[model samples]
Target: MSAFLDQLQQYIERHALFKSNDQLLLAVSGGLDSVVMAQGLQLLGYKFGIAHCNFNLRGEESKADEKFVRQLALSFQVPFFLKQFETSQLAQESKVSIQMAARDLRYAWLEEIRFQHGYAFVAAAHHQNDLVETVLLNLVRGTGLAGFHGILPKQGNVVRPLLFATREQAEDFAKDYILRWREDTSNASNKYARNLVRNKVIPILKTLNPSLENTMKSTAEKVALAEKVLARQVEEAKSKWVTEGQGFVKIDIQGLQSITNALYFLHAILQEFGFSWSVSKKVMESGSGISGKIFYSSTHRLLKDRENWIIDYREVAKFVPVSILPTTQTVRLLFGKVLNLKLLEGGLELVTILKSKSSVLLDYDKLVFPLTLRSWQEGDTFIPFGMEGEKKISDFLIDAKYSLFEKERIVVLQSGQEIVAIIGCRSGQRYSVGQATKRILVAELVFIG
Candidate 1:
């Protein structure tokens, strides 16, 4: 076996990436690294198939790459899967960079194909230099310890058997085997940040330290080890600070402040929620007065409550205030719920309002047309059932045994300065269907989840 193949075999063994009998699905871009990996895996007598992604960014060039990969698979008489993506459009829609979009699209399709074909593993050609480049990119992007941990050899069913090899080794293997592969012109272009790092920054860095990739790889592994230790520590710290609920976490700021290097510890906790170092520190230093201060991630949120930090995942269905019209019989509410509004014909006493809180009978004459359905806010006052005076919406939720997520999810039906109903909860006394009521509006709230 060649030295590259020997190294790959050792890397696979060391990482325990896959079993001898495991079928593999290889991600091949028709590049030198991937071609070398495919050649090496074939030489090792491993049963595998090739998969290619045509990103459609380079038009004809993308097709050429796909064609080369298909031919390469056919030369080995292996099953080949070809997929195309509108990478730019995907990026725009996902609000991510084209590179990120392409990576996401490629992996998703690879996993899908792997699952369907009963492939035990999906292998990618991410070599040593690529690992170093990723760490450098994450460093520039201000990523924390986990980011410096570099790429994993195995993540779920995806494995990187060639991760121990370098770019130069890959090129040498392709040349020594007389293997042909397509070159992407985009690699030489510095338009993308990664391309800039590869072509411009790495060369200068390599001049100073010829073995930078190996050196950085060692350093990254150390960081990964440190991250593992920190992760254990963070878990203990979370036990002290974070109280996990149905869909949210309540972080005790007071509990965190007692620890040494609280800010650094806080960063580790907030990192999972995608909070930046600055924001994490801000979350640490924020005082009790900033109760409403909110830090947002793409999929989650951290709210600064008086003595605690509130971390919550965003609802799949967004909360939007749909107009409640008189003619409308039913309206769709957020999170798979429905609001049914109907006129109560005759029997309209406040006795029925107390029977079922979910379905409220309210005075139709008291409610104004075109009422709005919205989430509760601080200081929003309504005469809650059994209460003579108005109570703050926040206070009412606290008394309702509502969890943080439930409190945040509570919707209020409003008409002018009054709350017509607190949907899915209590009835507003101002709109209560009293014994003297002429008309009654039966507002029934149906919760889907």
Candidate 2:
């Protein structure tokens, strides 16, 4: 048995990555680490095939890489699958960086091939040194426990057999086997952030401790264990403070704030929803940010409304202010909400103006036709009827104790340039219907469709 094979067996068993009978799709980029992995897998006699993705950024080097991997596949006596991609075009189309485009394309294509060819797992060549670089990059970017864990040995159908092995060890293994591999010139360039970390930052840190990779790997394993314990605790907290629906989650802030580790609980919860640390901290420190205060993740939006933190999938709604006319009794609105209008012959109690936040009664003479129903704007000033002075709409919401999120969704019914009502919230005191008023215009906001 080969020395590399011994380590491979131990690594596989230690992680329970795969059994000997499982067919693996080895993603070989013709790079040293991948080539070494392919050779090691072959040496171990695992039923596997080679898959290569040629992301055409390096011109001839890209073509040569494909050729090298194809030949290596022949040498290994395994099935070969080759895919070519216009990486630059993909990056532009996907609106991601070139490296990110290549990564997404290759992985997606590899998985496609794996299922198509009936391979049990996709064996990737990410190793210990790469793991260290990932960990350092995450730390630099300020990640939580998940980032500290770096790369896992087994993730879904993907298995990294070389994760426990170092680059030097892979190079040594290749030398021992006299394996030929193609080198990617892009890896040497510090143009990419990961390359900068790998080339300049990791090298500098290596001087402080040559065993940095092993040390980080050890720490990562320890952190992974701690993360599980933390996750268990967070899940327990979730049961207490959080509730999930079909497309959204609601966190009871009142319950969350009572927890001693509220910050940690918030971090864990927000992280699960993809909110960054900066955004999460801001939300927590906001002292219950106004209703309609929205923080976005790539996939989700977290909103703060009074005592609850609501996380829901983001719907890209284009809010084009709807025109409300005297003839228009009802109109559909965004977010499954509706706005309604009514006209009454007689005036109601003037006290109702202060009582009902949902309906506002304004003297019909004070309001103009063709009202603009729209969300709030900056510098919008409104006089809550009977107030001595005009107040900034923002300050009024704060005074009313509306969350940032609620404030965002607050609709303003404008008569000409003046705010007649913060629809469903407060009507301008200036436009209040008095006892002498003969006609009343009721601007009613219907919350849902």
Candidate 3:
């Protein structure tokens, strides 16, 4: 008992995770690790509340676990919060693995509750055994050094109090304290990859060397330190290679060539532009080709132009112009660009239609009569969605990061003098749609050099 207490005290003192007045949100699963963690914090007299997630995967067994945890919290006279997860549905919707989905939902909910309830930190029960397992998994899966670094003791507002303890130590403490905990049957089955490692690989490894956990933990610590140095170098390389543009980042091909790890540097820059790591690699590789190349990520696309790679936000660029019903004189904005009005089949793309799928295509049929094209003026306003009233077009333009010259050059496609779509800005929120409308204008931007 003294050994357990001594180790727990040493872990807390080494990490400096909490102060006397700190409020921690302890993640309790009614498992051995979590039970030991809660007891350790209690013994230390740290102020904390217990939180549990019931994923509803094991039917009665899941509820029983929750009940046990709730009663345990009551025994300690601590505040208990419980949440149910739609694990399968969430996994499908998020397009992530079940394990990843559960993790995201768990931490997101925990942080949300923490912020709302004034908790200083969130505590989890990940320990040395888990870290070793994670490192092994990452190595087997061909992951980078960061992935091999495994679980961190402190990450932002989340703290892992059991990081220094081995699974054997935790089990011993639980048994000595007579701590009752629920065991998930899935943990024993080899159906899951983690279970295969925990049950088969780790046991065989333990037989070979009982101190395998300690050795793996030491290796993970060394890898984490090396990764930190590599990360700092990558950050410095990124600053040299990337240039900030309006709503975009430009990568200098020359500067990128100077980077020590070009692939890593590209990954860092592309993430800043909201591109995926794979797409970023493709963009970087495409830099060698003579022709321009494009690769799409979830929210954006990387365009490798001659000497620069432009990461364009595809979502933001999906806007089409509305057709003008009655052709009006072209309005020449500050730039050489002119907004010409012409009759078409449908209302403008931005003004009339919004779609979840498809690019910025306009319906050219439903344009109203007397369309006017003009630049946005000061005090100009339009109705934007989810607002009580109209908003100034200039303010909207500023929010959208339009330069002075660009704002002056913005051509508004107006239907009968009522703004249908502020060309490339937003359709006047009020002039957009009605259920009765049959035809719509097809608006297209024509860039004249």
lDDT of 3 by residue, 60-127 (tens): 99999999999999999999999999898899998988888888989999998899999999999999
Per-residue lDDT of model 2, residues 1-449, tens digit only:
87877998899999999998999999999999999888787777798999999889999999899888899899888999999999999899889999889999999999999999899999999999989989988899877888999999989999999988999988888888788888888898999999999989998998999999999999999999998998899999999989864235788988998989688889888887788878888878764655567788888888777778888666646567888887888867665667777777777664455346567778888778788988789999988877868999989888887655455567788889998888777778878877777788876766652
Error of 1 at 351 (Å): 16
- The number of the candidate with the highest lDDT is 2
Clash count (model 3, backbone only):
19
Q: C-alpha displacement of 385 in model 1, angstroms?
A: 6.8
Off by over 4 Å in 1: 92-95, 287-290, 313-408, 411-449
Model 1 Cα lDDT, one tens digit per residue, 141-251 = 877777787798888989999888788888888888999999998888999998889988999999999999899888977887887897788889988888864346788
Could you give the C-alpha RMSD of every candidate to the true structure, in order shown?
A: 5.7, 7.2, 12.8
Error of 3 at 400 (Å): 23
Cα TM-score per model: 0.75, 0.70, 0.71
